[model samples]
Target: MLAVIRYTVPESQSQDFAKQGQTILDTFAGQPGFLRGRLARSVDEPNLWALVTEWEGAGFYRRALSAARLVMYPLMILMVNEPSAYEDVHAQDGT
Candidate 1:
């Protein structure tokens, strides 16, 4: 499963955004079933950013969220309001 949380941040806040994202990623690393995560900026839209993470399953993602709620709240509160969970249907084999 994938969880993608997007944010609209001004260029001035880019550094802060990345810093906070790294902290959140570190917190997630301690949770069970966390595969990998990335903090990326959009090439087309400089101010757009995404916190993308792969999980073993939706359940794992949910559990991670519940477990890290306090540590994640600051950054999570900045996320765009929308559905963020997805099931992979066509990922490359062995990836």
Candidate 2:
């Protein structure tokens, strides 16, 4: 199944969060079951953003979320692990 994880951070830690998030995405982009990240634009300010990251499958999504919780967002997250699930198939491969 396809998965989407969303979250928000407090306004104050936006910069730090964004920087670390970019690093994490870079680090995990090519991992098995990792798909791609869809970054959201801040509706209010530069500091605010909505992230909609889609993974290749839900198992990968769960494992990644667990690690991200432990390794990332030790302080800045206002919410976490907000994931939605559905059937997903790669467009190019139709698999």
Against the true structure, whose lDDT is highest? 1
Q: After superposition, how far is residue 33 of candidate 2 from its true place, in Å?
A: 1.2
Q: Which ten residues in a row have the lowest lDDT in candidate 1?
A: 70-79
- lDDT per residue, candidate 1, 38-82, as tens digits? 999999999889989999999999998888787767766567899
Error of 1 at 48 (Å): 0.6
TM-scores of the models, in the order given: 0.89, 0.60
TM-score of 2: 0.60
Best-fitting candidate, measured by TM-score? 1
Off by over 4 Å in 2: 44-48, 89-95
Residue-wise lDDT of candidate 2 within 1-95, one digit each (tens)? 55544456667777777776676676456457777775564676654455556677778877876666644555335544554666654545555
- Clash count (model 2, backbone only): 0
List the candidate 1 regions with Cα displacement exceeding 4 Å. Answer: 93-95
